[model samples]
Each structure stands twice: as C-alpha cells, then as structure tokens.
Target chain A: MTVPAAAAAGYSLLVLAAVVAPAVVLESAGDRGGVRGAVGADLIGVSAAVGVPAAVLAWRGVRRTTRAGRSRTDVWIAASCGLVTVAVAASALPTVVLHATTGLPVLDADAGWPVPALWAVCLGAAVVAGEASRRGVLRWLAG
Target chain B: MPALNRRQFLAASLGAVGSVAAGTGLGSQLWPLMGREDLVPGRTPELVLPAGAWSPAADRLTFAAVGDTGSGGRQAMAVADRMARGYQDSPYGLVTHLGDLCYYGSVEDRFDDVFTRPMRPLIDAGVAFELAIGNHDGALHHSDASLAEIDAELRLLGTPARHYTTSHGPVDFFYLDSSTPGLFGDDASVQLEWLDDALASSTNQWKVVCMHHPVYSSGAHGSTPGADELLEPLLADRRVDLVLSGHDHHYERTHPVDGVTYVVSGGGCKTTPVRPGRFTAAASSTLQYLHVDVVGDRLTGRSVRADGRVVDRFELRAREGR
Candidate 1:
C-alpha cells in the first residue's frame, strides 16, 4: 500500500503536530481539558485516515521492493515507504488505542470509513506518482 | 436455455481461474523475503551514553558534542557516562549532540532507559542540549514523521531554537542543520545563508560553526567536498574562528584554514580509524570531546578524553579586540 508523496507529507505534518500539540496545549491551555481533548480527537482522526495507510504502504513497499532486488530506485522507494510507515504509525497510535480501550468502535459509521477510502485513493496516487517521478528523473538525466 | 447455461458457466469459470492466478502470484512474490525483510529488526535503543550532567563556569565552559552515536548500547552509555562523570562540575551546561539521536529516527521505549532517562539531570538544569537532525535521524526509509516528532519532542524539551547562535562568553557558537534524506534537498544554501548572517551579525571575539558532518576528514565517511567548496570560502570571508563537527566517530582537528580551526569531536559513541587528511592538525581514533574556555581576548580550547585527560589544546586571539 504505497502512499503518495503529498498525502505522506500531510500525514507527517499532522503526526508531528499531534505529538507537539499536546505540549503546546500544556504550555498554553492552563488546564483546559475539553478543548485539549477535542483537538486531540481530531488529530487522532486525521492520523487514522492518513497516517495508518501511509505507514502500511511504506512498510510493505520497502519490504517488497527490497526483496525484489537492490536497485537504487528500489532502495529509494523502500526508504520512502518506510518513512511514511513511521509517520502513519506514530500519529494514529494514541487515539487508536484509546478508542479501543474505551470500547468505542474502531470504525464508527459517522466517520463514514474515511480512513479506508483515503487509503485507497492515496495508495493509488502514490503508485502513479512514484512511477511518473522516477521516469521523469530518468528522462531529465538522459537529456 | 442450453445456450444461456453454457455462457454463464464459461464466464464464472474464467473469473475463478483469474482470481487463483492472482492470489498465487502475490503469494509467490511475498512469501520468500518475509524472514529477511520482516524479521531483521530496526535499531534497538541501547545505552549509547550514560546518565549524568556537567557545567562550566562563566569563565570556562565544558560540554561534549557527538554524532552517529545511536548504536553500541551499553558500551556507548558507558563511554558517555564516563565523560559525564569526568566533567562532574556542580552545574554542567549540557551536551551538544550533533544528531542521529535515535537509531532509524523512530522512538522506542527501550531507548528511554538508554538515552532519555539518564539525561534527565541535564534537562533539569538550564543546560541546553542542542541537537541537529542527521541524514538517518529523519526517518529509516523516507518517513519525515519521525523527524517531525523528534523535532517536536526536542522543542517541548525546551530546545526549539534550531539553527541559532549563542554565546557563553567570548565564544560565539553557530549551530546549523545539514540536509536530511528526503527533505531539505541536501543543498547547503539556506544553512549557508543563515551561517553568513550569524557570522556577520556577531561581533563576538570567537566564532564556532558546529554541525553534524565534517567538511574535512580522513575518517571512514571521508571529506565532504561540497561542504569544503561551499562553506570554507564563506567562513574565510567572515574570518570565522572554529568549525566543529561529529559525523565520523573519531576526534580530529584541522590546521587553521582561512584563519578558522576545524575540530571533529565525534568520539561520542563508536570508534572509527583515523587517517591523516590534508588539513589535519591533530587526529585521534580514541573517544574524546572538546573543552573550550574563554578569558577576554585569549580563547583557549582543549580536547579531552573519557578519562578526563587533555588530548589537544590551542589558543585563538579574539576577533576584534586583539
């Protein structure tokens, strides 16, 4: 499940924000629980949709590409995949666990399975983009 | 009836055959390399540096800068702790880690014991544990999330000021971040611009540029020609004083080029062999760090070991009042 670059970047940013947001809230909130919780929940939702797929795609992509062979392209792809994987995992983790422990459905109908849908779209886009970028780079080099 | 039955059976059979072929193809491709790729573990958080802190006075400052020290577990911790104990002053300013704080650029619970827990004292102090991200620090493959998270964590830890200059006294320190793997594009232009600004802005008697990779080295990583070509001339133009780095895990000092000294105090984690390069003034493969002291215009710098013995010392005249 390779993730597209734009989506991956978005996920990376969101994950970092989620982790840092807590600290920021702690710094500024002065003990506002409701607001912090709302922000935290939103961050979790974003992570679930973008972050999980990005990570899954990256890990699988790296594993598949590396095992396939050791071309420079493969290595680069593998790395890209791995990076997305880490980002996805880091961002989605806290909320996923929290939801599960609280007996809340991991996939709620209100969210309309957005994470799964985004996974499909981003993964498709990533494959197309990766190939296109690779070819473009090669073509430019040849010229 | 007979024609319709034949068409339906044929179409269903074709679909089943295609599905089987696809499943088999996927299995054949994915099954073989599972052990090698899946089982090979990422970096485990081992003690790279021991737990302790140190402080240098208003007249003299003591600190350690190290890079590529994310591995070696207990051995790394032992060396770091020994160094920490060596500078067991009442208040230690902090450790300036060049980068590669966590191996594979991801967080691990195991690393807390090895990396974070021990350095709590330093965090407690006003000591600035400055860090710059490394090529490996951003992510294992291409993930920037880990990098962002690390940056976020560091910021929360009160080290948010990336690529800023500070002065203990007469020593003006310029901290810069080199390019990471997928992001920042490996161009030194932005860092160089900041560096140029930092140097031009500073009237501080001594200027020190500290980064992760060595612009000059004879170690395993070798010399970064791009850095030398791009950065050296700028430093020369600015009449900068000292350049410090820690990419290769060894200690090295270069002859003053363009009136600037280059020191590689990389012996923070692992040990690599030292071969003399064109600019090397003193080179050591042993674990060591630099202790810099400033008194008025006379700036004194020393490279000390884990055992607390001075390896190299030099003096540079203050830039202006001299």
Candidate 2:
C-alpha cells in the first residue's frame, strides 16, 4: 500500500518520539503492574502519543523534502536508516556493555519492560515507518 | 548509488542483519539487556533504620500496612490521601509496605513518584516507611542487576537486610525476603535461619512476620512453597502470632493455622478478582489498607478502604505463652 511521502517522514520521526515518550514517562514515573516482561499497555500508549505527532511531522517533513526536489524513495531510505540504527543499537549495546561490566549479559527479571520495551517499541516504530515510507506513495507531498 | 543513498542502504542492510540475528535467536536472548545496563545502579548502602522508642508493656503500637502501591496513579494517590486522613484521625507512627513498592521495575529516579510522592503526607508527618521487597522490586529475577535492585530498594527504604527484625513498641517485627521462587531454596538461603533465631529471641509480647509473599494465601499468588514446610514450624514453634504479606492484589485473612494468622493485604493501588479459600477468614477484591493496633495483650486489625469504610475487622489476643 502506498503512503503519502509527508506521512512517511512524520512516521519516521515517530521512531524517535516513541522512545522519547517512554523515557519521559520512566524519568517522570516508573511503576508497572504485576505482569512480567514488556508491558503491552505501555506500548499501546506510546503508539498513540507518537502516532499523532508522527502524522503531523510526516506531512511537514515530506512536504519539505518534496519542495526540495526529493523523491518518495529518499523518504523511504531515510526511514529505513533510522529504523536500522535504532534496532541495531537496541539489540547490541546492552549485551556488549553488560557482559563487559558485570561479566554476564544478565537478563534478570528486574530488567522487565523498561529495557526490552524500549527496543521493541523502536523496532515496531521502525517497521511501521518503513512500511509507511513506501517508494510508490502518492505525490501528496510533491511540490 | 549516491553517497547518501549508499549510507541509507548500509543502514538498511545493518537493520536486516539485526532482524536476522533476532530471528535466529542470538539477539532474542540478548533482548533482556535492552538498555544501558551500566546505567542501572548497583550501589547498595547500609541503611538499617533505628527503631523508635516505645515500651510494649506501657505504650500501644499502631501502624498501617499496604502493598502493590507503586503505580503512583490516582488509585495510589487515593489510598495515600486516605492514609493521610487516617493518620490525621489516629496518627499512626509507622507505615509498613508489603512490597512491590516500585512497579514496572522503576529505576531509582522514580522512587519519589512511586513511593515518596504518593506517601508524602505520611512521610512528612514523621511516619516511618518500612518495606518488604516484592517481585517487581527486583526480587523475582536472578542477576547481578537484580541484586543491585534489591540493594537499591533496601537503601531507599532503609531496611536492615534481606531479612531482619525490628521493633515497634511491644511488637517485634520479623521481615522476610520471600520474593524469590523458593522460600528456602535461595542459592545460599539463610533467611529462614535468621527468622528462626529472631523469633526465638524476641522479648516483645507480639511477634509479627512481614513479607512480600504470603505464608498462606488463596489469591492470585497462593501460599509460597516451603512457607509451610520451612517457615511454618519456626513461626508455630516460636508462637509467631501474625504473618503479614502482600502480592495477591487483594485482601485476605486466613483462619488461624496452628495458632498463627496469615493475612494478605495487597490492595494498595489495584485490585483483581479473588475468591476465598477454605482457610480465608475474610477476603475482598478492593483497594484498601490494613490498620492494625497492638495494645498490651490484644491486636486489632481493620481492613479499611479509601472511603473510610472498614471492610473487615479481626482481633487477636497475645499468644498465651509469649
């Protein structure tokens, strides 16, 4: 399915927002229910918070890129870059650092949602952004 | 491809590799270390709280117990507000938390929001906060970080150790770290030994054991394994009068089992459905706390909701020999 270029750019920005939103939340208040592992509810909330702004930013960013004579392929590539960067960072950093520091890649029950959820969210955001930033999208943001 | 497109393609390829790694289960196993694990603090402190002055024979001991209150939401605030109101009315000197004080595995930065902020009223009034470590508070998992989380919680709340004894007037409280799966099978478990000795040596008229997991519960988390086998004999042998616990997200008081009453008061912030078991004296799926009064030879416990309603009440006389 083709997504408007503007929408694609906005969705990519959401990759950043999805991570930021929860960081702000954890920074502000870090309490979850009894369920172990990633909190599905938190992911839903993050999606809503990031999705709205993503929509707006997609409109603006794609428009700006189109006006500057860029193609839908460019937007897709940019989103693809962002997604990959976040995913790789999310996957590799903790294990490498934890193993180096603590002599173990200690994935205990206490890590819970904050760590994994952040990565899952970024991966999810990337996937969505990648899909939304389609190369064959309509020229809605075309100038 | 242009230099910029080349960079983008390189990133896309890297992400694809990551996806493959994850699919092949290499990254999947490493998912638990998702964030900057180094940033997770491990500095533990020696923070044993000094016991306040109170003579059990002459003075009465009053306090409140709550659990599962780490949400820091309207429900937690409501309970705190009620606790404040309760304090205003009767002025309790201490508030004991049954664990899970910080939910969602909150980092140290959230201590204020998950704990101090909501219980501000009680804290400001000089009411001491004592915590029993919960599963969510870094006790369920086994890792260096988990130990650090336990330390962080201990330091935050000023608990003596994983398990230790503290006094409040005539009542001597023995707190246990029951968050791990096996009550007695902890890698190098000494909690039971400590409890046994602590209970035997107490001079107070009341011996109340506080823990995050229940000794006898019928709620979501039933009785802890080895609780009856390993811990029960000690309590019954020592005439330990009460076992206070929170983990089930509801309120349940058991019928006296071998002269010891087990109570689960886990409805500090949230509630889930709970049906009474045969041993249950009183049970309810409600948001509430337990107000307990310990006088000379009698202890009174009242299950109170945020609306000032007393859902359940029971009285226990001092153990005959103790």
Give fnat (model 1). 0.00
Model 2 whole-model lDDT (C-alpha atoms): 0.64
lDDT of 1 by residue, B209-271 (tens): 777777788887877657777778898889887788887767888998878788887765455
TM-score of each: 0.53, 0.59
Off-target runs (Cα >4 Å) in candidate 2 are A1-143, B1-57, B186-189
Candidate number of the best TM-score:
2
Error of 1 at A124 (Å): 48
A19-79: candidate 1 lDDT, tens digit per residue: 3332232212211211122112333454345444544544445445446553434344324
lDDT of 1 at B1: 27
Task: Supply candidate 1's per-residue lDDT for B61.
Answer: 56
**TM-score of the second chain of model 1 compared to its true counterpart:** 0.72
For residues B106-166, could you state the per-residue lDDT of candidate 2 as single tens digits? 5385686567767765665678888887888885764688778878988988887877778
**Per-residue lDDT over A1-143 for candidate 2, one digit per residue giving the tens place of the 0 to 100 score:** 34575365556565555334433332222122221222234444554564555445544655666567776556555544444444444334433443333211242213444434443555455435433443223232232
Best by DockQ: 2
